[model samples]
Target: MTDIPNIPFVDLASQQNRIRADIDKAMARVLDHGRYVMGPEVAELEAELSKFCGAKHSIGCSSGTDALAMVLMAKNLRAGQVIFCPSFTFVATAEVVAWLGAKVCFVDVEPDTFNMDPKALKAAIETAKANGEDLAGIIVVDLFGLPADYVSILKIAEENDLWLMSDAAQSFGARYHNAPIGTNGIATATSFFPAKPLGAYGDGGAMFTDDDELAEDLRSILFHGKGTSQYDNVRIGMTGRLDTMQAAVLLEKLKIFDSEIVERQKVADRYTSGLSDIVTCPHVPEGCQSVWAQYTTRLPQGLDRDALQAQLKDKGIPTAVYYAKPLHRQDAYKHNLIAGQTSDGVLPVTDALSLDVLSLPMHPYLSDDTQDYIIEHIRGAISDLS
Candidate 1:
């Protein structure tokens, strides 16, 4: 019996190794400067990120959650104001809204892209208005590295006079209609958690926007809402500034982000082709590019998704469920949903996705051999159930 090599869900070490020298230099420079908080690297990274995403400004923050919170704080969202977002995403997307005392009306996601469905968003707005709720804005999450349908969502926001925020936490490097993800909405927020496609060494995030005034407000909100000087506090804020060390690391990573995105696409192409026949593979809509944050596949109906996960584990291949339960179904949020009604009656698509989806190992550095092993074991697991 031979021991199979354990495959990581995200191979950050491989990426780090590829650019070890550059990363070392970036860090060493930060250490020498000894200005760890809001140092030069922070502004340098922000400028570089703005250029990369074609935004006028990018404000660095402590985390993706804070980035969202800062934008909402800048807007001064209050209780009774409703923000529409898909229930299929990480809680951070809606958690910020809740923290700001704003109502979060959960919407259903598209069946294929796992992104916020624009039609569902429109329906949610109507449902909220019918309940006499004060509609405030929309936060479209780019779930699993694919951008949401921004074309229709942007139009809907304009029609209703609502702020549209792009939660590009997983889709930062992706594109929609050939435009970078960050520039499509009024504001875009992204995470730099270690597992993300363009992660830093630790927790970090950034907000991108073309609006000069909004950008200024975000910057102020990120730093205790200081007016003109650090001592001059103009409004309420939080400690949400990104660490200079993380920014230094990100600057090195950003240098190769484009090439890495291309590599991720190649890995996704292989997974889609190999696993499509056995299980439902991911679908990237036309004119959109995913960073392949997680190569999730849905198990066929009647197959126990958990059992298959266990089988893959025994084979030394790791698997995870992105969200075994959608946010609306989670205990904390169940009370938020009207008894017998959600925005679209039941959020059918989000409910179904929760039961069947499983995420396999994914990253820019996934090797062909490891993927072949993964596909073979997946087929074996399915066969055993049959």
Candidate 2:
């Protein structure tokens, strides 16, 4: 092994340096105004994001988890109502459902795209009905920045009369059949967790929708259920407002998001071309664009994933597994599932994905030189292991 440059999985500093002047000024303005909570920048960012994503309204919230929860809250979900979701994702996606006292009917995902499988979703819905459970809605995750099969999933939602929510926390800037992610569902939730394609300096999130009534309810729920005035409470809510400082940071980042998404595509293309022979690279369906959120790939069967990570680590290359454990397997959710909600037998696809997935260094700021270094070492490591 020779010298290898250390690569940060997400190069936030490089991104920050590109717009340091704009960021500094924006933060300074917020500090001078002294209105930290729900200040001008908050509304400004909401308007900017709403216009950019073609959503009639965008509401900024505390975090991606809060954003999803707020939408569910506005929908007035209750216990025993089943919300179907994929198990092959971050816990936040399904946890929000359980928190609202709704049963999370776990579904499998497509092996290629790693997004929710509409067939599995339909099966879950029917199973829920067969077991005499109430079908409330479906939350489709845009896993690893690729939008789920909205063409099929939307049809299912419509046929079943279920409220469809797109959890675009990773695929915020992605596209589905020429339309932005935010427009794909009745409501879309995204995160600004400093690692997302279009991230803020700290925690933040937003929900996008064209529904006038839903948007109003979300705003009210976001502000502790304030109606007419801040002091007047009309409904139960949480302190879910996106702070002014994070909003200011996101405003500047939003300007360059489109171009950065292009850069991300280039990086992913290069990685796929270089490593496809050795590993199972991510797949993007036709007419879809992924922001390449994590650049996750699967290990070949019989190759120990953790061993490969150790090999890469010795050479200063970093790797991660997005979700090593599926949500259904987690102790917190193991016993709480409703009957007939397991997608036929066990969620085999989700279970398999949890064991095989490995996220490589991915970010728009990842330079071609760094990519070459990472790819060379990965190829070498796989070859040696083979």
Quantify all predictions' global Cα lDDT against the true fold: 0.88, 0.90
Off by over 4 Å in 1: 335-345
lDDT of 1 by residue, 1-386 (tens): 37777899999999989999999999999999999999999999999998888899999999999998888888888876888888898999888887877777888898889998888888878777788888888899999999888889999999999989989999899988998888877799999999999999999999999999999888888888889976899989889999999999999999999999998988888888888998999988899989888888888998988788888888998999989878887777655553344444478999889989999899888889988998889999998975
lDDT of 2 at 206: 96
How do the residues 65-123 of candidate 2 rate in per-residue lDDT, one tens digit apiece?
A: 99999989999999878888888899999899889888888889999999999888888
Clashing pairs in 1: none
TM-score of 2: 0.97
Best by lDDT: 2
Give me the displacement of residue 69 in model 2, in angstroms: 0.4
